[model samples]
Target: MTLRIRRRRFGQIAIATAATTALSGFAQRAFAQRGGPILYGVTLDSTGENLIIQALNLATGNILPINIQRRIEPGERISAFTAISGRFAIATGPRMALPGRRLGRRSRIISSTTEEIPEPQGLDNDAAFESLLNTNDNNLLSIISLNQGTPPFRFANVDRRSGRVNFLSDVDLLPNRRYSNLCQSPRGTTYGTSLGPDTGPVLVQFDFANRSIITGKARILPIAPLSYNKNLLVNDVADLALSPSNQLFALADPTYEGTNSLFIVNTQTGEMTFLRKFAVQKITFTR
Candidate 1:
């Protein structure tokens, strides 16, 4: 229902102030809006789970607040609601009691999953649409919305690609309950998550067609034994996700100074590998 996510500081920005923060330890350009039809979205909550969605014309810098009408019902928080072609779908987190705290008030908070936006004029055809949704629990959820320009949900086909680090196909691996955050996998077939109270990256695979996970689960391959010869932080996986290049990275909070860490992973050996990390406050892809 209503779960508190990690907290981050936010700065005020008038329609003209392009929100910009240090990312990947690099000074990413501030949100740019000096061109034509704008293209960009900002979560109402600067950091943490963006509760409110704001659409901005990156080109014109005009911002449109997303007014979602769905309530607390099953699959309320729709994922893939914005797909490319057709056959679309969305999901929901567990519901909470309405303000009245009435009985049986448990329901998802999002529906009409499809949030259709006008395509940027002259946009490339190959560009795929992607969105993330919070699982009822601390889990990762993503959908590939296709040809979002048409009717019926305004999406073509939507499916659950990841459930944490594990792919939805790996449904058998992840625990149905308990966890903090879930992230996308480089391959798009799986997703990873922060360890539960027990502390272990849960990597699972998916079967988007069936809206289910497959295979078993595996702990993120630990830092390479040789990597131990260097340095590695333990105990705080703040956030998890994959970059546009399809590399696995984690936003970890070590017990020492500056726990927020980002890095890619390599599991090509059929095992997880903790690659190097970045020092950015936060990182997002442009796909």
Candidate 2:
């Protein structure tokens, strides 16, 4: 199955342009956070026939390229770009083949493409989606899984150093679940919620027993979307995410019923509040 989502870069950076005083609060926190490198990566859009990613000091257009580079995947399109501390990442969606045309559904390969610094965050067929890059003691990649080709969504993890993945649980985390989202906090911890299958955003967490092993555990944390119904396009929620504040924020698809809007949820206290909604176009975010 081909993965679906958006990719963007540096996100509409607000502070870099703000005056020295006005920028102190947000900028100090964002740029001065307690972490390692301040680098970020994203699959850049060259506008037409040209796209590349490079590091900048918010000054010169120097564009210091990261070692790994690849034109947007042939059939795979990049939709979102983000960076953690300094590691850059890109979200990718599949370019499905038409009926009886191209590879078609019989391709038998997962197309969701996620790229991360050090290497690709996701694989050509890992079928990865609804992902986020975590930057702290160890860079962690969080994402929802479509590996089963089923309705409910599943959770997966990647080793920041090796770019390898492990199931959240022995029995696919959030098994038979759907319409889910994931987010990491300022504490070097990751949080997630089960979207569809008629359940709240259960909190699935990652734990490292030793430097070499990773284990996922969950606590059915509660979250309300302020407006969730049976009609939400389950597949799309699988591409959902939240702000650093635990507020719910997801890509909105109008084809969906009940005025599907993106909002913020207070994960610390299972509360849902509407953020905004999209009309017809798709919402893409980049670090």
**Count of steric clashes across candidates, in order:** 52, 32
Model 2 off-target regions past 4 Å?
A: 1-71, 77-82, 101-126, 144-154, 160-162, 168-171, 187-190, 197-217, 225-262, 266-287
Candidate lDDT (C-alpha), each: 0.31, 0.38
Q: What tens digits encode model 2's per-residue C-alpha lDDT throughout 47-112?
A: 421234433222221223332323444555443344443233444544455577552121111111
Error of 1 at 132 (Å): 3.9
Superposing every Cα of model 2 onto the true structure, what RMSD results?
Answer: 10.4
Candidate 2 lDDT at 157 equals 51
Predicted structure with the largest lDDT when compared to the true one: 2
lDDT (10s digit) by residue, model 1, range 229-274 = 1343334344444544556554444434453433344534213343
Best by TM-score: 2
RMSD for each model, in Å, please?
A: 14.0, 10.4
